[model samples]
Target: MLSTLAMSVPADSNWINFDVPALIQNFWSATFDGLTFGAIYALVALGYTLVYGVLNLINFAHSEVFIVGCYGVFFTLSFLGFGPSVPNLDFWSIVLNLVLALVVAMVASALTAFVVERVAYKPLRKRNAPRLVFLITAIGVSFSIQYLIFLWRGPNPEVALTMFRPTPIFDVFGTIIDSQQLVIVLAAVVMMVFTDQFISRSRTGRGIRAVAQDPDTATLMGVNKERIIITTFIIGGLLAGAAALFYVMRIPSGVQYSGGFVLGVKAFAAAVLGGIGNVRGALLGGLLLGLIGNYGQILLGSSQWTDVVAFVVLVLVLLVRPEGILGTSLGRSKA
Candidate 1:
């Protein structure tokens, strides 16, 4: 069945076609799609930034955190009796299901992240292991989670039933805005703002900042390093979970064990593009990457090249400004 579907997808004969007028005609729609996806990337990028900001270690398993959240939402909705065959749901039903899915995904991702930190990282921290050790552990944890899911769920992608049909809400400059795009973009912005404010204004945020600045000084100042580290992982997981829901909403084909790898890589690149340790930089990098990739794909007339386009942008950015658009040196993030 999968092979049949794959074969059924029309090949792009115009892969190299660069039609300026056609691109101009589809500009708004592509931009909207890009921004929506960019929001998801930004949300995932936060996980990278938050963990790196405090621990100075890249949690490569963070991608699995996102994959777990995707499965969480899928299972939650499935339990609610929403599968691929279900018809359109009522308004309140859709809302309730979405809210429940979001909560479940967040909790599941957070717990997964916490476990990864405890089992894979804490021991190394105690031994004061080198950065290479941490990197290997992260990759190991990521693969473990991926295969574990594969063993449990098999290699099939889990598809969700369409709960909310995207309807045109309005039109702008010959571009029709759909419900899904609006919800995704708005929700991402809200979550990003809340996270930024939480990190900047809250007491715990101050402690995280303090630890990021100087761990020994923070410990001497009575800040609980372990607690701060755990909190950062949890927060990162929460954002990844939110992004998972948004991702499924935008592309409901299904969730697979390996689904998060590429998107996670892109999100990581976005973190680097914006300045890895800077929170606001993640947001900027995500949106910018999204726009550039989308435009590039449209111009080139091939969706398969989107990832290539994004990486090319990343390379270009690194070559030009290694600090990222908003990134500063380590321990000097504006957050």
Candidate 2:
């Protein structure tokens, strides 16, 4: 898209607007907004990290997994009697609705992840397909899932009714941190922390790491590779689903069949920026990417430049540190 824009736009002075003043003025707002988006990115990145750490595959279809979760969220909210307008529910009722939405989304996405694994990936694994074959299959699966949703829901985006009205939670410097942002950020942090602990401290986590480090040896030692792979995909799905819920909360009108592409790209970039297989790296990369993209949009005075800026920054980082911000792979980490 950036390339197409650059090619189509005239070589006039107005094409690339540079607005340092706007950037300076909106610094705090952008920072807070970036963190909200970064939180979403980090959750999605966790999905990418787990799959890549174990299978050494990008799992591009994970984006579709997220969108599936979005559908689940939409249905759950609709079933709860929430409409396009804000509901007049008491606080506890509202909380219950949100909790239900989150759970349904997670389960939906996780189930999709499991099915995709069994239907699309397991055969390739059994056949001992090459890395390129797996990559192609992943892309194919992504498209298949996307178009399937397209056929089911059509091309138009569904605007899920407002589940909660955003009220001011607190003030950070000059920025008024709202309830929606607070919830999304807090939820993402809690999920990431739990995932980190699970990966680091649990027996299943050790099995995952053992497989990632040396699959054959791990398998020989009684670690079930199939079960671990399934677990990894499910974990990724859970995170992606949570990200989907937060995304819908932030942008109630953003749900659609193809909506996951841009988000998946950003999440994948976050994973790569933070060190693809590292736990902490995804979080750090996501936050930084969000800040950079948001800042670029302000500075350039065009939202179109956001992704271009993020990718440019990613390239620069890779040039400086090829292994990403946190250079440790999950399999090899001692702590």
Candidate 3:
């Protein structure tokens, strides 16, 4: 009976589509674009890494931090006479516009992160709340921000004026590298490097490492625990804000009430993929996840199934290396 049932099954099943030929054909373009999106993921992942490093909290609300920064970019551009139509501004003017927008996004995200810490997480810390309680609060704060944005913006996406048409920057093999991809990838790398430097080289960073290694002992060493935690969140927010700017630049129509949900999940996965507790690991994870996800989408034959492919790859990686590719290393020694 079992043999008969197996023999009756269709040889050509459409349920799980795997278009390997298509993936191979579009491999170059997909890899390039995947890197673009992956940069955004890595930027957001830093927030998760930082908070988890210091407080041992996941900070699910960090996604909202990113979306809030996107909104900041939208409003800043709108104020500078940018709309849905093509801009008549000169090239230098466009540069200025983006620079201003970046500042606003950074400030907005940083402040939001600071407030989340003060209002949402600090009280819990004062009470010496359980880790589970901190996790729940992070989720709650995330929802609260999401709904507030929903109430204010409704459900539609906010499309912005095109920042500038992406020009060809250079070519890599057969791939045409565009301005947008260049900016996103380059900016993300620069920021990540700067963050790594700060964490490893600066005095304040030393204090942060101390806290991550042993919070009680760090406090005893005359390091201000609250200040270090606040600084960590600020840095995370700054990176998230930068990610938002690049995100809106790459996909202008992505700005919405809950735009950060899926991106946030991907970033978190990237963090875990690189090693949840490690800064450098998050960066590696983000880039690899991006490439893998792009290849997966092409192979699977649809953008909708991208997440399915991404998570499957993540599971595979976990099975092979539970500590992640780079393992969990913050600025300090391995936890």
lDDT of each: 0.87, 0.91, 0.90
- The best candidate by lDDT is 2
List the candidate 1 regions with Cα displacement exceeding 4 Å. Answer: 1-17, 85-88, 329-331
TM-score of 1: 0.93
Q: Rank the candidates by lDDT, best first.
A: 2, 3, 1
Q: Which lDDT tens digits does candidate 2 get at residues 37-117?
A: 999999999899889999999999999999999888999998889888989999999889989999999999999999999
**Predicted candidate 3: what Cα RMSD to the true structure?**
4.9
**Model 1 over residues 259-317: C-alpha lDDT tens digits?**
99989899999999999878888898999889888988876656876888889989988
Q: How would you order the candidates by TM-score, starting with the best?
A: 2, 3, 1
Q: Assess candidate 2 and give its lDDT.
A: 0.91
- Report the CA-based lDDT of candidate 3 relative to the real structure: 0.90
After TM-score superposition, the amount by which residue 55's alpha carbon in candidate 3 deviates from its true location, in angstroms, is 0.6
Candidate 3's TM-score reads: 0.94
**Model 2: which residue pairs collide?**
none
TM-score of 2: 0.95
TM-score of each: 0.93, 0.95, 0.94
Residue 217 shift from truth in candidate 1, angstroms: 1.1
